[model samples]
Target: MMLMAAVLQAAVVQPAPGMLVERRLAEAIPLAVGDTVRVRALAGSAQPRPFVVAGVFEREADPNRIARNDYEVRLHLPDLEALLPTHDRVDRFAIVLAPGARADPAARWIESVAFGTRAYGSAALAEETSATFRVVSRFHDAIGIVTILASAIFLLCVMVIRVDERKRDMGTLRLIGVSRGTVFRAVVLEAIGIAVVGSVAGAGLGVVVTRIVNAHYARVYDTTLRFALVTPRIVLIAALLGLALGTIAGVLAAWRLVRVAPQKLGER
Candidate 1:
């Protein structure tokens, strides 16, 4: 959540008043923290002011991830005296609201002001701020849904086959004075074993894949892109989901098999 908030803050880039904003350029001078830099004015002013550098950032400028041009640079913000020399123009501001303050009310208040007639909020602000978080959340959702559906289909098939294969065995057990409850429990245990194995293997594969991708990307770009690494919480949820799905399939299969009479089993 901290990472999400930090990324959202970066995504919402609104320059302060009279600051000249420049995109990352090719063969640009690299910047570090506390490095003072200067930016050419958009108005083509003769002199450039030494602006104290706050920070530097690197990110893919592409909206779509497939085609990407990676760029890195520092943003140079001009001071007040620097603003006095150039044609004064303040385009936008990135406002950080206090925790207790409602963004909607603040936006409305800004709109009520005479100068705030052009103020816009809500959808536009969200688009600018929450792009990365929304994309990543959707991606994770799709992966999780697919994993559950695939597991369900696989478990269903396994349960159906196991029931069919053990029909004669189940019939014999019933004739030998075993209750239907015993048969149900045995079937549930078998399903539990299958679910445990599958969940463990799948979790291991996910971890390996994440590590490989992370290493590859870092080697190529030297940039840290946060991956959705599996945690204990995620693993626990996956296990619970898998066990539930498997038990349901197994019980349904076992119930249908138990309904068959011993005589019917002999005919089969």
Candidate 2:
């Protein structure tokens, strides 16, 4: 009753026999205002009945909703009553309270008055439904941690190989009275530059992959919901992590090269 009251508040319908089609249904059937369409209940032996398209309505957008859009249509109370064998009973409905009203207490009150009804706050319903999405997020976090470890190891190995190649040059600089501190700073800066370049390339590759994956899944699933999200913050954080790993790798590589005696650098 309360739900119906809310809908009736904004609904300006004539006493004529017609039904409102959801935007998705309207577009799918190529229906226009005043077009007549046959509707039938999914269950029972009810035969199809013709109804004029009174209006079209788009469902409110919910970005976080994982479910696909519903092609629901609404009819007037009396029309619905004739179509459904519901017998003046509604199976489910939601209630909106006044502003600043307490949900827990209102839910309790509603349950008390409405026997055989279970009323829970919207927060509870949202949490219950979003549980799977939360699990997927944790899985992504685990993969990220493993990726970071692998990246650190690979960066270290590359830096060690690079420093080994430059051993002769480092030894020559040391012989020319170049201080170890200046030599260390040079190697560190080179590593940082490599990291910056790699990070930018990786970000670009990620964007391309995201587009491909999203487009492929959209075709497969026939849904408009996004399967992945890549934000600027995520990219920035990855770049910073790369820089930190580069700095650490540079320090270790520089230390290995500088600790060797300048005269012995020519030896394998």
Q: What is the C-alpha local distance difference test score of each model? A: 0.69, 0.82
lDDT of 1 by residue, 76-169 (tens): 3445535445544556656777778887778778678656355556568668767777988899799979978887988988988988888888
RMSD of each: 12.3, 7.6
93-196, model 2: which lDDT tens digit per residue? 79999999988898888789768988867888788777877998899999999999998888889888998898888889999999989888988888888878
Whole-model lDDT, model 1: 0.69
Which lDDT value does model 1 have at 147?
73
TM-score of candidate 1 versus the correct structure, residues matched by position: 0.63
After superposing candidate 2, which stretches have Cα over 4 Å from the reference? 1-16, 22-24, 56-70, 76-78
Q: For model 1, give the 10-residue run with minimal summed lDDT.
A: 18-27
Clashing pairs in 1: none
Give the distance in Å from residue 248's predicted Cα in candidate 1 to where it truly belongs.
1.0
**lDDT comparing candidate 2 with the true structure:** 0.82
Per lDDT, the best of the predicted structures is: 2
